[model samples]
Target chain A: MTMPSVSDSGLATDAAEGSVVLERVTRAFQGRRVLNEISLHIAAGEFVALLGMSGSGKSTLLRALAGLDEEVEGEGLIRVPTARSVLFQDSRLLPWESVLDNITLGLDGPDPAQAGRQALASVGLAGRESAWPGQLSGGEQQRVALARSLVRRPQLLLADEPFGALDALTRLKMHALLRALVGRLRPTVILVTHDVDEALALASRVLVLGNGRIADDFRLDLDHPRHSDDPRLVGYRQRLLITLGVTESA
Target chain B: MSAEGSTLGGRITSSTPRTAQASSRPGGTRLVPRRLTPLGRLLGPLVLLALWELAAQTGLLSPKLLAAPSTALITGYDMLANGTLLPHWLASAWRAWWGLGIGVAAAVLLALASGLTRIGEASIDSLVQIKRAIPTLALIPLAILWLGIGETMKIALIAGSVFVPVYINTHAAIKGIDIRHVELARTLGLGKAVFIRRIVLPGALPGFFTGLRLSVTSCWASLVVLEQINTTQGIGYLMNRARDYGQTEIIVVGLVIYMVLGLASDAAVRAIERSTLRYRKVIGS
Candidate 1:
């Protein structure tokens, strides 16, 4: 693939545009193609949820969009905002550093401590500047991780099954926190998950990957504070579960 | 209300602030009182001393073989009053200080060299392994032949004793950091210098302290051996002199000093570990 636009610094040329465009992107490992000629465009401030089965290349596609995987042997033009951040399934916090330092790490600014404090406060972690990551609960650690990502004020946030490891209750709390933060920050977010209800509840647009390509794309016009039993979402959930090959009875 | 919506608001309002605030407020209250441990540590030594005094007074144990606690104490006090113990103690302390300092510096340098790069590991690791296989005491003959029974030989011996544990532990610590953190550093665009300073150095610290505790004990042991080599000063020299004069009381004093030094250094390292590793006080830890 010719990456004429992706610079050596990996900063997006059209960063202010805050868009992601992938054209005919394909990736293979040992002659087995994992991603096959996938093309998609995400506009600024759009919440996009990617859904697929375990090996359906959902994560591979998300990694590509995040500029973390670049060894694909296919013709494509992948463009993402230079100001971008990724939140993985694990909260990947530095165990030794305090929560505030972890958020402000490698930060370039006039007053990073102040910014870190503000970010922590936004995540409801105020007065936890001196607390270590290990001291916090799993949900709290993920909140600090969220604060770390949001401290950069990225235009694009790519989250890969961030709440997959969390318990059901913690996942609900995280979903609410994520929704509130995304509403406030309005970054173009692409969340990768297999949870059909999560995608239906959180995303404005949900894309389903099947056989290494985009098989279904749905636009949901549901209002904020969405309910799991909204009755309107049952069809989308059933269709997504069917797309994921999960039979209702089996 | 659905199960999800009912729990969502209740969970958010009830769980978020209470636990976060509760966990953050335990720093002062959680520290066990410092006064408790001194009494605990003293109990063993005090009971032993009492047993020794009773045995000496009752004549159950011969004083020739083992000096009484009172005799050892009087001899120690007389040596202190006559100004004999101070010079010997100073000389031994100076040698230990120089030897341990040099050894730690060299070990840290070697560890960084070997731990950071494949080339460094290839060059230094095999030679260090060979050195580690041989005991430091086995090198005493060669050490004397090379540098004679001088301060240089003694100091070098102590340095050699301290080198292995510090280097091995520090290197392992550097290599043992989780790769996920390295990815985090790269994703954050941390520069090479910053990565070494922030991640590599702090990550290696716990192991470094472990190695330091080991090396401190070994450093004292090496001194005990090296100071017996035609030494006119030091605690080892004092003990050697006392052995000839059949001054078992003085010999016991020397032994007590060594014990004190070892205990003190270990306690110092433990204090540092406690303060630095306070982050490890997670639930059930």
Candidate 2:
């Protein structure tokens, strides 16, 4: 194994207005506490991935950011009173609508028609505006979902294992697309996933959630659009695997 | 990812291409897929007609009781050409159309109000359920007593026929939309105007069209029952008069025309729905 470059710790602090601040955010369902006083801060315009086992509170935390679950509390002073969008685990495309309309679902302006077109083009779905949701494959539907969150051009982007359903290769492509999009749009993104390699290849900081709290937080200090084969990524991958107690590179 | 083949990290998946292909055969032209659906739909009606004609010609059915398809078709045109059938059809069309328009408008207002408020929904659900279960046919005596045996009575009859289907369908569509989409609109900071105009209406449209389609068909068919009791000039009146005179050919003609008109109206509405939805979702800007 080879050591890789770690650039200066010049975080994109100014790009995002309000960094995510989670302070003792506790969530309970019925009587069972799903998340117990989980507190963390994700910097502005920085890519962060929350890695955890299924049923862990990783998705719950992400949903809280999206304000989907307002029941969770004690999340302190969020900066940049800015817009946010959430990408779901399932693509959740309206079954009857076309891919184009799905992307433009929440967008509003005097000219949504133009915005929808431009967003479709950005996601490389330029010619598929009229294609029905059922007509698109799983990967394409996921891409449309990505386009959906992107169409908002949100300051805070929350994703709940958005690529968990895609094939590995498609996931990789989506990761790259997401990386490029974040690089260009500079939206502060918090991605929740069970895939360690994905965390290494994409996020600048990786946090693991265990027993309803942050078990580990490791800053990669990697560049935007980092390669999957980056030597630093290889080391990080191994470390994540040992932490998760698995050797498979999946 | 290029649009050609490879996408998402070299994963190749087929993009649905709405294309036309050509086949090689005698006088083979470019094999633009014919819209066979429209033609295929005609088979059921045609087969029924064939069977009916066969039954009538074989004397298995009495001419006084059942007219052959051929004679019925000819006599239908004969009546229409001479304007003997026009007044009846026109009258039925007027009552059905107006009653349906009023029913739909009122139902839409009610559904919207009920769906938007918990109190309204609770208050109306029981009432609507009770009203829905009460057979509209049983209301005829009351209708005559209140509105008399006039146009108002007939219109009431028509309204009673079509209201439940439209109202139920509209309400169901409103309830069926995913809650997530509703939140999406809210976070976007759109005012109530844009939200209802764009999100709520389109989301409810498929079901709304579904209700409208069924009710319209019912409107056309149920008018005959309405016409039989009171007013004159409608397919029902024509059918009744033909029965009285033993004019089975005229009765059959009226029946066939009514069926054809109902079918044509349904097809027209369906086309409108498809075209509107397609235009709304038109891809590639």
Give me the candidate number with maximum TM-score: 1
Considering the true interface contacts (CA pairs under 8 Å between chains A and B), give the fraction that model 1 also has.
Answer: 0.47
Candidate 2 lDDT over B1-285, as tens digits, reads 275444553442333332444447535556876555767978998899889889988999999788898898889788889988888878888888888888888778777767767987998767877889988878888988999988888877678668888778888888877787666655555577776776677788877888888888887776667788766688888888888999999887777777877888789888888876663553432
DockQ, structure candidate 1:
0.36
Off by over 4 Å in 1: A1-16, A23-33, A64-77, B1-60, B282-285
In candidate 1, the residue pairs with backbone N, CA or C atoms under 3 Å apart (3 or more residues apart, or in different chains) clash, namely none
- Best-fitting candidate, measured by DockQ? 1
Q: Which window of ten consecutive residues has the lowest lDDT sum in model 2 chain A?
A: A2-11
What is candidate 1's TM-score against the reference?
A: 0.84
What's the C-alpha lDDT at position A245 in model 1? Answer: 84
Clashes of 2: 7
Per-chain TM-score of chain A in candidate 2 equals 0.85
Candidate No. with top lDDT: 1
Model 1: docking quality category: acceptable
Listed in order, each prediction's TM-score against the native is 0.84, 0.80
